[model samples]
Target: MRLRNKPWAKDKLDQYPQYVISGPELLKGKWNGVFDKVQPIHIEIGTGRGRFVTEMAKANPEINYLGIEVQQSVIVTALDRLIEAELPNIKLLNVNAGDVTEFFEKGEVERIYLNFSDPWPKSRHAKRRLTYKTFLKQYEEILINQGEIHFKTDNQGLFEYSLKSFSEYGLLLQYVSLDLHNSNFEGNIMTEYEEKFSKKGHRIFRSEVKYR
Candidate 1:
């Protein structure tokens, strides 16, 4: 992942001096300047093309939103959209999801949104799935005590596996819906992949998991 030459890399917006931090060295992390008085921050783990989080930021003025993505290409695309929207409550980060806990302070985030995260369907790649316990533990560290994760995906197997993982990790499965589009749920915002999948008639699986 060389970044010295790419156009997106050269103009990247994430200007943090220490963007990469080790998990063991993150207990004293702080970000008061970037976000003045963290007030109910909502984090979206994989913001592809930035439709969902951006729109959510525009719609909700009180809550701060953070969008994280590892790929420079994707984050660059998302940044372009953010610039277009001129969203003030939104921020961007380019980093691996596995290391998110280290970047955020404890209780800094109030909610998490997992929108169509990579399924990693192969049995051997289960740990790579964002809903796996490994990543949930990372989320737990940064999220407030009662903070909840809102997940939506079109993969049945992954959804079921996620429910099991959430339970195994001691998170309470608060809300579960097999079909999100038809559910009369409120405050629903569909991501880029979600809109396409839903239009194709895929049944979206949704759930909210909180600390039990």
Candidate 2:
């Protein structure tokens, strides 16, 4: 998807300071206090349009949600959606997922969600894939013991490669589903991309992996 540069995106986000943490001091090791509760923090990387994280916050009010999107224009749509929803348990971050540990403290996050992330199908670009071992190792620094990575994608090649990547990094895999919508998995939330792809008769793959 081609991203339109929204010149006013940052200004729009500034209007919702309560939902978007700006300063570095406000974030570092203080994420729990931002929500004014010590609930489990769950972050969704590459939260395009914010459908999945927004719905997850609505469905699980006890869990706090933070969405990270590197694209300013993409995050604007999500921030707008979140503002309209009036969800207090969710926040948005317009930054790279690779810089997660910079904002969050070690063991600060309980779960991470990677929904329909970029496939980066080219073998040469494997390191850029969200499920790559390098990224997983970074996640391990901030995630609590046994914290899980819940992943869903329509690309079979990425899914297969991710399985190997997670295993190679010593993650215990569970809830593996070749076709998520056709399976018995409960509490499945549909992302914007997931809905679009599934409507086109594409199979959605899902799995859960935790650091071993």
Candidate 3:
């Protein structure tokens, strides 16, 4: 979906320095200091409208959740949700996911969430997929040893491709669900895309893969 530009979005994000972090690269390894309490950090790479991250923060107060979304207009909607949530354990980063390693140090993150990412189905665009080998390497660098990546998508092709990529990268598959909502999995937090797709009877694929 093409996002309509919000002229006021940048100013709104700048106004809330507490919720929307600026100059995230400066905080690189010192992320723990940003929150009121030092805790394990988990980040959602493309935190669309902030529903999943905010809900997760509400459910897991002991953990800190950092939401990364590159688009200013899209992230501004998320910022609005965060403002209403008023959760101290959550923060937003309006930066590109491709540059993630620059903002985090080795073992700085405990977990990563890839929820309903763009499929990028063309063969030539395979590398642009979030589960591509290049991205896996970046995720491995910032995540702790044995750190897990929880992924969900309504696109079967992307799920299958990601599984193969994870296997090739030597990641251990902890769980896999072909039809997530129909499966017995518990504590599922649905993203905006997930909800829309599932409501249309789409099968949701989910997996948990851990680093070696």
Model 1 C-alpha lDDT per residue in residues 128-170, reported as the tens digit of each score: 9998877888888888898899999999999999999998999
Looking at model 2, residue 190 earns an lDDT score of 96
Q: Residue 91 of candidate 1: its Cα lDDT?
A: 75
Ranking by TM-score: 3, 2, 1
lDDT of each: 0.79, 0.90, 0.95
Record all residue pairs in model 1 with backbone atoms less than 3 Å apart, i.e. clashing.
none
Best TM-score goes to which candidate?
A: 3
Cα-lDDT of candidate 1:
0.79
TM-score of model 2 relative to the true fold?
0.97
Off by over 4 Å in 1: 1-9, 12-28
Off by over 4 Å in 2: 24-26
Evaluated at residue 70, the lDDT of candidate 3 is 94
In angstroms, the error of model 3 at 209 is: 0.3
RMSD of 1: 4.1
The candidate, 1 or 3, that scores higher on lDDT is 3
